[model samples]
Target: MPERTSYDAVIVGGGHNGLVAAAYLARAGRSVLVLERLDHTGGAAVSTRAFAGVDARLSRYSYLVSLLPPKIVRDLGLRFAVRKRTVSSYTPAVRAGRPTGLLVGGGEARTRESFAELTGSEREFAAWQGFYGTTRRLAERVFPTLTEPLPTRAALRAAVDDDATWHALFERPLGELVEETFTDDLVRGVVLTDALIGTFAAAHDPSLRQNRCFLYHVIGGGTGDWDVPLGGMGALTDALAEAARGAGAEIVTDCAVTGLATDGRAAEVTCARGTIGARRVLVNASPRELAHLLGEDPPPPAEGAQLKVNMLLTRLPRLRDSRVDPREAFAGTFHVAEGYGQLERSYQQAASGELPAAPPSEIYCHSLTDPSILGADLVRRGYQTLTLFGLHAPARLFTADNDATRERLLAATLAELDTHLAEPLADCLARDADGRPCIEAKSPLDLDAELGLPGGNIFHRELAFPYADPEDGQGGGAPARWGVATGHPNVLLCGAGAVRGGGVSGIPGHNAAMAVLEEG
Candidate 1:
């Protein structure tokens, strides 16, 4: 139970963001209550032993950590950390019936060589240097603002201070930018994967939705490095929950918030257990769920356009490209059939409600970087974990038969991956004690039913630009100072749906707490 009829603030969810808010608010001495639907916290940022009788603990969903501000870590005194991968990404390819790939991040010189080797010229490599250099600069300018008050579009633009870079990143379609910058289809696809990770949009979408997704991916930590949390994703959330509790926040699990009512100044949260009141309400859920809680009609349902598959492998799979070692290639993001043409073709197919013949996906071997996630015995026996993310597999495709589509898509996606592998992934798969392959695939619908993600959209909905559009209002409205405000005076959004939110970042949670503190 909440242990109080009323509190200074009530959080509707106990995901990472919710825990972040609770930690911050409670540390500030505010009476805060966190209500979680799941029996545990962490939400999507959780690690579990998925396979029966398996000792390897895998980051089940939302595997990587980026955009989690250092300020939040220090402020909450969370006992957590992340390790960067030596190689950024490796995209395997087959050209002229010969195996090849582009490997990013082994120092600039090596990356340049890889690009040159793939494109047969230094032209693409030079362009790559310039493109990422600009994004690094933009990230430096834009990332710090996420934790602060909402900046007007002009203010952020002024801070960015380069019209050409600004126009390319914020104004035009990311797809167009990619086409103009890179000539190689594989290189272009590798660059655009960041933009379409969880987003379903074409490169030339006039809405510039892809641009927003691109910015989020690149601006993380001002360096855009997606680090692996040391103990898997759950380590961060576990630390967050502990920090929240240590600061005196009350967290009640298995207590679902059934309804909510607010009068702008005070609010009441009705849950599976009982109703509790608070002077302020902070919702760490999707906008759709928040609207329903407020008794308002939610906007059109958000849809997730990705497939997640987790596997415990007996050993790393050998690659078709003999130039690269399996340990080095698997340590970073491994791109599969994600060439520029392939991505567009897949998106077009999925948009028309059909699976692509060759699905584009990326794989990460977490145990390669941090073997602590696996049991000591498993580690000694050459075990590893593969966390795969298949792009452009939207929720709509599963509307008819979720399980069948998931299985079909998984099979197709893996088959595509095998095209660049010396061996089928199944051959490397470890079997559970029960003699079952330690593999599980999740579709958008499965995520929705299990995680309550609106249409399984990870960002909750379309991500808004970190900066507020000047036409929208002054500084995103006086009330929306931290991009966490709602129509109600006492209610705020502190979830992935918040402006400048999403990722494993606690920016929204920190902002929501700051908003409450400032109001008082």
Candidate 2:
């Protein structure tokens, strides 16, 4: 028989969120144990040498640091660092047989000029500023509430104090809001892209889940800026894991939890290795996964709609428009075939079980922003890494055949990219030791199989608004005000499936710790 142990709290899964919760709980003098199934931690927020025999350390899954709260970093004393991108985003366009594009975030003057050039109207630029200005105000009001107890919707609305901002973001369709605000097709697509990232829905979908997803993406850290991690994503999770260990948390990898049972006094967790009893249990797995462990029906399946591609490039590809330097354009988000109409058609195609001929995707060159991801030898060889995120490729399309669909999608995506490039993107290939080009594509099914992501949904499931629903009232045996509550009092969610729990942010973990401490 396996030995059984006891702890103040036990956290399942060793993802960044679980580590964060362990750090906070252990720091509070509670004996905590974190169990991870994988040999390694970090979960999706990991960096690896993806290409065999290549020295480039690519952020294999989750990249960038935007949603991580500064309070968590400061309180935990994490040593991670993130650098801001000099160039925000660049979208390729053509006018009069001349290479032209819209560039944002380099300079105020440059952004204004690019917007005017793209739209042929200064009014559109002004409207763009006005629209974001509203979002900025909304972010300011909402971001602070994330770490605190969930506020009632009425209370949050009062805090926002702007009916127009509330209606535009929460009540109205994001597609309608973007289309009404921005005139340029590219500009509109750029804004709408945030709503669709990792979410499988059209901007106009009445479910309003996309609105919640967009809110989290934009309100992250209150600036909505997706900054590059200095030493790749691993640095961030490593710091969190170290902090948890320093706080006296017992972290056990290669130990997978198989079942969880909770009584009024204590919770018991049975894992592959042994059974452990705790005063409380914190789950860092997705809601669906949690339900399976509890022998309950899972929530509605989540369907992810994105394709991830990682590549090591011999050199940056030349752009069709010679006026813009490749380095500057690739420094930030490089939009490819993401015009408004193109995005709509891509979604339509994918929804109909066909890969879009012209897929909407975005690429960013990490080395251009932070060369630390590449080894000294690779850097000297002028090699860089490109991360591509293709949108509108839903998981359902790949259900029949993942390999064939992935290849077709990748081929179509690269071909579409060639349209805007002076040379074929494949021409700038860097070969691995085996002489194969350093390129890898992961479809939604691939993500599901590799990352244990249900339906490959990165956020775990549809995002929930941070604020409490007013209609829920104080009835129906509602769990608690912390948003980490579950049907079982001792089993709290500390992962992306919790309310306000998406992204790389440790908000859910922090809140879960707070919940346990408060209950005691």
Candidate 3:
């Protein structure tokens, strides 16, 4: 082992959150260094020249960037490095044996106005306004504080009470909130889809506060629907890396960490290159990622993490309608629930720890809207980039005899797309790393075992409490004792795998830094 080089802080994994933590800590006058497993920074939020001659977002994994505290970005001076663009989602009705754009310019205003126009109750619009206000306020109040350590008891209580969070946020599932607010199926559907983006919950599941929590996450730059990072999700990470360096944080990439050496007061990170020591060590990768680095000494988060199956496609999936809102049309986020029941069934199947026979696939295409990349040629080449996401299911489902479940899932997704699109996708389909088809998918269960995620569940801990668990009571709050942090005293935790569920939001990293600062 090389001589132990010491620093104020050492962050493992150059993912966005880790970078965020390092930037914040360095700004606070702490000497910091970051180690990344990949050759480049930006763990999941990376763009690579892996696909074509062009550098498109490689994974777009955990797709979309929302709920990231803008204050953090500004504070770190990350504005110049990152770019953002909004993508709209379109769901055309297969009416009259053809697909019809739901929003037709003037038609949108009419539809929006008419629904709320009648009965003196603009329920949908009013609900949307109120919900956005609530979430926005919540983000402002909660996100900024996450950058600091967990507040004192009085501070926590006062903050929660002052924000009226107890009344509005306590134990509420986002689905129920949406249903109560809107009478229309489509509006509720959009919100539900957003809530369940990277989660394992069903849209109608009662314990879906995490889904509600995800609202703040998906509400990235701008409004109305989710936003994708400009130039693909990779740009966001690049900006973070730049900001971290600007803050005097050193970054080393392609150096995978093998284990952690700690003496209770400080942490020594053992990577392929050598061992680097720091007063504090923050792990920005998923819990499993951390476990891989720490080996068996420091246990991974109790809650399991999921495996991600990423696909960089040559063409876009064909949607049923044309002339849809180009923004919504190009927007990659999709709510696959044909109706509420389908969503429930899918969740039920997932809970039984089995991949759903007809898994609901949330699809997105970032390359469609981003202008700098290849969109038209992808179409001309008979393809457009697409990603299909589903909940984490049982590992045995993949290994079971006959593999009936896997085949069913494979058939269901393509068959459902056929129901919505004009032509079959068989021709546009190409090869992938999975070899089964485009990309053979992996569930959270498989990810936990393979990637070293502890619980076979994503998020270091549950984001939405009240619904998260009654027995443990480790839900809600930015900082809690005995959770989300690295079990080791000096080692810290970050990433979506941190507490409060997963997404591209940098809260975990921000909070982890605050925790270290507070401890010091």
Candidate 4:
């Protein structure tokens, strides 16, 4: 064994959440260590040199940013290191069979302009305002407090009693809810897109609580607009690494964590590098991956398998006959949803175990927004860059069943773009696979089965842990019996899998830190 190094806590993955947890623990004067499987940190939240000189991010995988909490950004002093920009979705009206306009944050003036264009005059805008307001309140009041201590038993009961006041609202499908609110197809599509992103739910799934997860971005404050972190998503991770080092947390890259060594009191983590002992080990890898490392059931609880594919494009996709202005080109997210029918079919195809033939893609053009991408020489080389993110089809579709599938997916995206964009996507520089992520090809599905997780679920346990069963101690925002502290007395869980749902938010780590401080 190498000279054993002891620490207060050892975070397993160096993703944004892991880094956040490390920083919080170190700030409290505790020795912390972070281990990353890849050569660099940030897990899925990263930027790499996919092409020479052109630093691009796997935007197609885990793209978009509004879900992160503002408190973490301000508290971590990541204001300068990681920043946000305004981005919205633009879809051509007639080209894709119908018009799809889902714009997120241009300004007060632009908001008015967009509202006037919608079918309804006063009633439609008023309803949108109501939905946005309600969604914002839910995110701000409910989500930020997710990691905090649960309410008392009586409080929990009372909250549920009150919740019954809007039983129909909670029970109805998000699509139904949106339809009841707006009359215009464009406006309806815009609002409903919120519920559909990252979700495999059918457009008419009655159980979908898009307001629960989707609203987190619409009104969680700090300019509800989505933007790319400067340089690449990598800059955000690099800043986290910098913060971890600054706060006295030791970080080792190119080291993969294989298993947990639990002594019933503390955990001794087994890694490719060796054993790392810590009072508590926070896992930042997806819940699925953590489960794999633990060697238990796959993908914990209710979350389904996460299949991601990313591609680097040579030419920027030029939307034909798009309503979005050229100046606001890179300021919004782009989607290929033509209407509700198309959206429903996409989900059905994925659910049926087959990939979508005409996959819906989420596009982000880094070269269009970031000035650093326009550096000399590379600009001369016509090195325009963008990311095309879409659904993962059947794994069987790949060449090696894995290798060729990635290429096929990328090729399909270019073919789709070629049909609409100004110039066909050309330069094929790099590709990343989220199913088999990092250098070792450690997949989320493999992680879930190894860990005790239910379905290779990555959101940890399930998204509805607190809201689902009343018998569970977490009912109505009440903490689990485990609370922030782990089953082991000396250990604590400070990763996204811990609480408040998932995202780049540091709530799990921040909450765990408070518990440790209180325990001391």
Show where candidate 1 strays beyond 4 Å: 470-479
Worst 10 residues of 2 by lDDT: 470-479
Local accuracy of candidate 1 as per-residue lDDT tens digits, 1-520 = 3256889999989999999999999999999999999999999999998988989889998998889999999998989999999999999988788999999988989998898888899999899889999999999999999999988789999999999989988889988789999999998999999999889988888898899999999988999999999989989999999999999999999999989998877889999767898999999988888888888988778899999999999999898999899999989999998888999999999999899889999999999999999999999999999999999999999999999999999999999988888999899999998999999999988888888788889999888898765443223333388888776778788999888888899999999998889877
How well is each residue in 1-520 modelled by candidate 3, as lDDT tens digits? 5534889898887888899888888888899989887678876566544443333344444556655667776787776333343334444444446565333123446445533433235666667657767766555455544444444445644554544544434446666666677776655655565555445666545665445546445434424235556666677778888888998898988787888878767778888767777888887766556666667544424443222444445555456665443335545455454344565676687678666655665566656655444445554664455666654343445545324654566567657656766567665555543344454455544555433344444454456431123334334333344234555677767676554436666777777777766666
Residue range 1-520, candidate 2, lDDT tens digits: 6444999999999899999999999999999999999998898888999988998999989888888889999999999989999998999977777778888877889899988877788987898788888888888888899988888888888888999888988898899899888777888888888888888777898999879889988887887889999899988889999999999998889988999877756888999767788999999998888888888989889988899999999999999988788999999999988888888888888888888889989999889989999999999999999999999999999999899989999999999889899999899999999999999999888988887788999888878877887442212222367788776778888998888887889888998898888877
- Of 1 and 2, the candidate ahead on TM-score is 1
Compare the candidates by TM-score and give the number of the best one. 1
Deviation from native of the Cα of residue 142 in model 4, angstroms: 2.6
Q: Rank order by lDDT, top first?
A: 1, 2, 3, 4
Q: Count clashing pairs, candidate 2.
A: 0
Winning candidate number (lDDT): 1
Model 4 bad stretches (over 4 Å): 1-4, 52-60, 79-87, 95-105, 108-123, 151-170, 206-211, 288-317, 322-327, 379-383, 391-400, 403-419, 426-461, 465-492
In each prediction, how many residue pairs overlap at the backbone (N, C-alpha, C within less than 3 A)? 0, 0, 20, 25
- Tell me which residue pairs clash in candidate 1: none
Model 1: weakest 10-residue lDDT segment is 470-479
- The estimated TM-scores of all candidates read 0.98, 0.97, 0.76, 0.79
Which runs of model 2 end up more than 4 angstroms from their true locations? 1-4, 470-479
Residue-level lDDT of model 4, residues 112-214, one tens digit each, is 5666654436666677787766655444444444455755435533444535323423455667767777786656766666654444466566555454445
* Two-way lDDT contest, 2 vs 4, winner: 2
